[model samples]
Target: MNGLSGMREENERLEGEVSRLRTELSQAAAGDGGGEKVNELLGEREAIQAKVEAMLDALAEIDPEIAAAVAG
Candidate 1:
């Protein structure tokens, strides 16, 4: 695959991971004594989201149309 396709796949994977982490975080919040776990999940999700944003930025620089399509 080319850079655009590779980045799109990576972005999709990262987004899926973020969604999973959100679910886990929600479950942890609903339980007792899961403060630490919740924090960890939040941090992980944030990092992954940041990575995705950076990748989008880079992709936008390379090809705005492809980036827009991937982002949507």
Candidate 2:
């Protein structure tokens, strides 16, 4: 039970972090920059976003209890 609760909390935290990263990426994308670092960050952000989404999907399929706990 404690483990499940901890997992739920971690999941929520990760979701929030991913949301912030997406927002940051969007803001950075709008800025005027022409460098490989910017391109790399954009790409990394996109990949991380996709992975986070995929993780959410997988968790949803794998555990109904955790999904309900983590979901709004």
Candidate 3:
């Protein structure tokens, strides 16, 4: 029971972190940074998007019902 609770807490934390990272990536992606800076941020945005996707997949596995509710 304790482990289950811990897992839930960790899942929530990861979800929050993923959300924050996604926002940062979205902002960076939209920004007009010049040249190398733009390319670097775009790369970071791609990495963050991949990570966010993975986290969402994991969350879906954990609570598909919730994911479905949110999606619909």
Candidate 4:
């Protein structure tokens, strides 16, 4: 696949992961889950966020103006 298509797929996967982690975090906060579970969810969210940032950075390398607009 092309660069943008590959990145779009990665972005979608990461966004899905982030959404799932947020749901788990909320459930933990609601007391349906434990401290360890909450911590795990938080870690997963952080990892996904890092990946998204990296992808954005790559996009910036491809087109700084567009990336800046998207980042905003």
Tens digits of per-residue lDDT for model 1, 1-72:
369788879978897998899899999999999899998998998899799878878888998796778678
In candidate 2, stretches whose alpha carbon ends up further than 4 angstroms from where it belongs are 34-72
Q: What tens digits encode model 3's per-residue C-alpha lDDT throughout 1-72?
A: 144465567657666766776676667667775455556656765775676566556666778785796477
Q: Number of the top candidate by TM-score?
A: 4
Please provide, for model 4 over 5-62, each residue's C-alpha lDDT reduced to its tens digit, 9 standing for 90 to 100. Answer: 8999988988888888888788888895478898888888888888888888888999
Query: What are the candidates' C-alpha RMSDs?
Result: 2.8, 4.9, 5.5, 1.9
Pairs in steric clash, model 1: none
TM-score of model 1 vs. true structure: 0.80
Ranked by TM-score, the better of candidates 3 and 4 is: 4
**Regions of model 4 farther than 4 Å from truth:** none
lDDT of each: 0.86, 0.68, 0.64, 0.84
Q: Pick the candidate with the highest lDDT.
A: 1
Which wins on TM-score, candidate 2 or candidate 4?
Answer: 4
TM-score of 3: 0.51
Work out how many backbone clashes candidate 2 has. 0
User: How does each model score on TM-score?
Assistant: 0.80, 0.50, 0.51, 0.82
**How far is 21's C-alpha from truth in model 4 (Å)?**
1.0
What is the C-alpha lDDT profile of model 2 across 1-72, one tens digit per residue? 245466567668767876776676677677766345457767776776686666666677778975786597
Choose 1 or 3, whichever is better by TM-score. 1
